[model samples]
Target: MSRKKYILIFFVIILLCLSLVSYSNTTIGRVLRFGPANANDYLEFPYHEISTTSTYFKFGEANLENIVKSRFYDVTYGNNQKVGDLDQFLEDTDTTSFIVIYKDNIIYEKYYNNYNRESIVTSFSISKSFTSALIGIAIDEGYIKSVYDPITDYLPELKKRDPRFSNIKIIDLLHMSSGVSYKEPPDDIYTYFAPDLRKLALEKTQVVEDPGNSFLYNNYNPLFLGMIIERSTGKTVSEYLEEKIWKPIGMEFDGSWSIDANDFEKMESGINCRAIDFAKFGRLYLRKGNWNGKQIISTGWSVASTAPYGPENNEYYPNIPIFKEYPGYYSLMWWGIRRDDKNYDFYAAGNHGQYIYVSPEKNLIIVRNGISYGKGMESEDMSWWPIIFYQFANQFPSE
Candidate 1:
């Protein structure tokens, strides 16, 4: 071979090596390019080290008139309805922070492990609830005609890409019944990356079941739903959020959403925000989407989103150990833990125990952010969370 040809081949190999190194240094690459090395690490991270990420949109400041601080009582919670101190329970679960709101007042708040009001934690799948709210707002604005419309109506590109996309209602995505060919194991790499989400959106997978026929907590459902919202509104979710909900509702901090190396929003599990701001979002829904007397989201939409998709008996989840006793009642990317007729708890939950829990009957809102690390912690019966939160709410007598 000529000397010139040998040098050309050498340069090509050098360029490939350089590209691989550069990709590893990218934002998403730094955090996730190498991927999770263990199940616990994949599901949760220590509180102080939770802020690493890729691209994001910064929210502007909306000062809160009140940042009331309150002391927590000796709240009882955990397996077998065990009674214990709230602080101890929090420590065992590796809680980063916990906030309790009652009757529009901050009743109990605490930050642990160097986490404070200003410290932001990753929302994980709790962001799905935010995506769901955006959908409700879009529906009210007539950006999209109806939630029941087939998703292909908004994103024509998805038509005929795969048979699975056909006849899939927007509501099915909201209700996790699109049968979108997904499984959410704790160590699933798709849960933590943006590229994987986009790739899944376009993959041609076989249609395993009819849409609206069952429940499956697939990330693609919310990811595609967010895409539909962007298409209909001509805005990223963050831009629309600031205009419609964040500023009007009075969020005090500039929360952010994780974006991929390619700069697309993760859309499902990538939201990051101060713990207090998380409560405010819950408060908006608690007041039936009315903030400061403005109906930012329709009351009907809020009610329906929080309410169960159908009869409590019909809901079913994948046969996973963590969800051994899954609620039969799933709602629009939210869970209505139908403990009973009157005291059902509506909540937005994330992996490793992040939650925004709202119980309308008690006029209560609870936010628990955590690393939530331990052996088999992912499979723990988290339904106990609302039961204990209700117990905390009942500490104060009603009028």
Candidate 2:
């Protein structure tokens, strides 16, 4: 044999060895900060009755495939200029699906290379906001008494152990002001990847600030809230959500939940749904939890969740660390923005570019889904996409 051929074979053997080791070490499960068991092992909730039977919108017979492919609205001047150039945008950023909905109709929906509209995309932290909507529905149904009630009232297991949590109101969790000692932007990567996120969240031995006095963005707030919902309502968050929200809204696809080591739904980030289903959620919020005059989530609670409450005295929650430099607002699970002389725009955003942007004034909803696992700060900022989307919003000539 030739010496060159022998050297090439030796390099290939070494590469195979490294690949095998990497595959063996990596766990076969969804990545979570902390949890005892792999997420896939979690038990799924039984399918509930879909409320679409009585609703005017029919999914099974609709030409959904053709609808997604056709252009329903004229691109805005700004979007028009950038339409042909979106390849550069996608290349520069991690974008999976980009869609635009106007006046309860889909105008433009496109998936990335090797992706399609039917692909089930993970919502990351965007699921938190959806969970908030579920909580609102539970309140409307009288399953939950009120947001002011102590969490212990619903989940007695949390009482007496943590004094700070003793009086923590349900609203406080929604506001991300539970006074729990949590490090945002995570100081230690290993600690963030623990198996039991619930234990880590509540086990924080110290209370740095009084509950409701300060605002801190942490996953613990939502995860804890999910537990409270399940304990109070005697149903998993996914079960309650399907019955109360998804089925009613006529969501066409089945969504999955990310489970913890104990097989509990993570609730903070484990939501996965199709792009159209996500748009349906955006539309539901756009209608203030109403679908054709049917009250899905109480309109009053819907308004409250998206509206701001804080000492900042601003109509929207300010001082979120991720968007500190940017002019944005946080309300419950949604992010609000006030553009120059434009209407108040709010959205449900997740890490790595998952977004459900809604403009009530224009009756427009835009959903962008992406897979940005290790892109760092740029994914969190989402600075460029919003700017591009706002420009897209301007394209529709005012009626």
Candidate 3:
């Protein structure tokens, strides 16, 4: 070896070490460590378990005589029409679990890629819907005064830091219009992998615009909501969920919620549960928050949470229609699509193709969990899943 070459190599090693030391505790460091988020992330992170009750609610099985062995739907591309079946499409699209329930009966259920009834998949952003439900429950139980209450009521530290934060209401958070200054890649990665979420949420969140000015799809909204739920109920978000919804609904299996290093629930995402159990949540909303005649969540809140808000009220991208001809909407963390017949079908969607789609007009619920949001479709067309669900729902009679 040459002396000058050896010295150059040593300098490179020192530079690399300095870079690692500089970025170790930053969002960039976490992203480099964990990589991109995926469906099975619960296995890689620390989480708190949510247990189910002794009595479980079971769905009626469809009669073998009426069971669908093969199903097909039509698809077209560039003037060519092709026939696509449910099973093949799901398999090709990297779907892990797919379930269709009608009138409280399991009509169609399929698991692919080594996933089965017992496998657990992370809920991703679908956890936001669960957070919204907990907030409603807190209000119903008097732990929260009202949706109109300023968020500062529960998180007064924000007001102490910036008085403008007092103008942000709980409803603004629910609507994803809190005006919290957040940009993707940076803000998102920080919230997802930050070891101490409460500190990041309080210290990093800043009011960039008025509270109710417009919809911005801020991840910080749910973080603040989680903190509010914790403060108001005097319990962790996971504890509140267990007492209010998990045990009451009689989940078939124990689920888990991912937590930061400080043990705070990741309210923006990170719920892990079986696909069948996830379907139960859809069924609960399908029955208008009535779980077998038990009013778990208020009907008013149920309707308000899923129903569409006028486009004039901060209904922007992703909430808006993917295609101009069809209509779409968002309300309280749930996504909605207005059918041509003037009826609405709403869903809870997450990153990487996790969904719980509900069609009230047809009395149907479809649950989908996937690995990569499928490979064949363009990125912008990801919302097309609900349309496929709508086509599937149309095959059934309206109840």
Candidate 4:
């Protein structure tokens, strides 16, 4: 063969090899980006170092079939008319998981093309609500003196350096009203995953406004709360939640949280869990913090965390905008909605479509998990689903 022909053939082979490698890496990164693609690769962390033993509650052995048959209600809307196709909705939004639990029973559970029930999907900011639940449980057990206590009480490191943080109450963290000037945008994902998230958060010492006066949904609020939990209990947030909440609930599988470079769990958006286990939490709140005859958390605290408490007279923080046409409010960590005269719903919603909707009146709980890639609060399509769920809630016969 001529020298020129040989050179051309060798160049073509090299290009083909480069393309194959690039495609493989891209595919792998996408798979590992969200839920667990393989069971063997699952990571486990400690759950007992964060809270008291009494705070945890174990589930009793019950018939799954019986629970589903008795507790579930067929929910349909618009005279059984089709508002939209479920397949089309999922495709348009790039949803990986969808779970609907009604009255403690699994109603509709599904996993998308690249996901499964065993996949430990990321909860995004839904982890914030879980972190808030831990704080509530800590309060109920006396580990936390009170939400009114200044964060400096637990995290003394901030006492002298940051006076604003010293006066900021723990409750303020729950409402995202700590007055920290950290704007959480979708492009700022690196801040949470950085080597030192606390240092990154604390770098912005200039408070734009006084704490408790205005509402700002900054990620620093939850990050600060996680630090408080750590300093108070001498354990990481993951360890605290595991000991206090996860194992006690008889979670079918183990869950995990992504740790920062300093090994601290990113309390703001580091939690990962199965859809069913997430439903267990919704069920816990539905039963008013009592599970299997054990008072895991104070019903009063649960009610307070999920209801509106800010200056806006709505359930959630007043600063955050509600979905278009949705009567949404921000509470301690929950989101509330005055759906209609007959329906009232509140939920723990995270970025990227992670939600746990609790309806006490109808004894219904709906869990939706998806991989939504977008900016803060703008990632998920909030409308239509809540409306559908509200309509479904009305399907049950009036008491």
**Which should have the higher lDDT, number 1 or number 2?**
1
11-71: candidate 4 lDDT, tens digit per residue: 9998887666544423223233432322222243212222223343333333343333333
Better structure of 1 and 3 per lDDT: 3
What's the lDDT for residue 76 in model 3?
32
- Cα-based lDDT at residue 102, candidate 4: 51
Clashing pairs in 1: 315-328
Candidate 3 displacement at residue 39 in angstroms? 1.4
Best by lDDT: 3
RMSD of 4: 7.2
Q: Candidate 2 lDDT, tens digit per residue, 1-399?
A: 999999999999988876665444222222221233222222322122222324434222223434333222222222233333554455444667877776766656677756787776777778888889988888877888898898768655566666656778888888877776666434222122434556655554345676777667767778778877787789977788778787777777677776655546666666777777888888888888898789998889888777644355442333443346445667777877655454566788876677888877777888888766213324333444554565566544553
Best by TM-score: 3
Ranked by lDDT from best down, the candidates are 3, 1, 4, 2
Q: List runs of model 3 lying over 4 Å from the truth.
A: 1-26, 63-71, 75-83, 311-320, 323-325, 340-342
Is 1 or 4 the stronger prediction by lDDT?
1
Model 2: lowest-lDDT 10 consecutive positions: 38-47
Clashing pairs in 3: none
Clash pairs, candidate 2, are: 34-194, 34-195, 35-195, 35-196, 36-195, 36-261, 37-261, 76-395
Each prediction's whole-model lDDT (CA): 0.68, 0.65, 0.83, 0.65
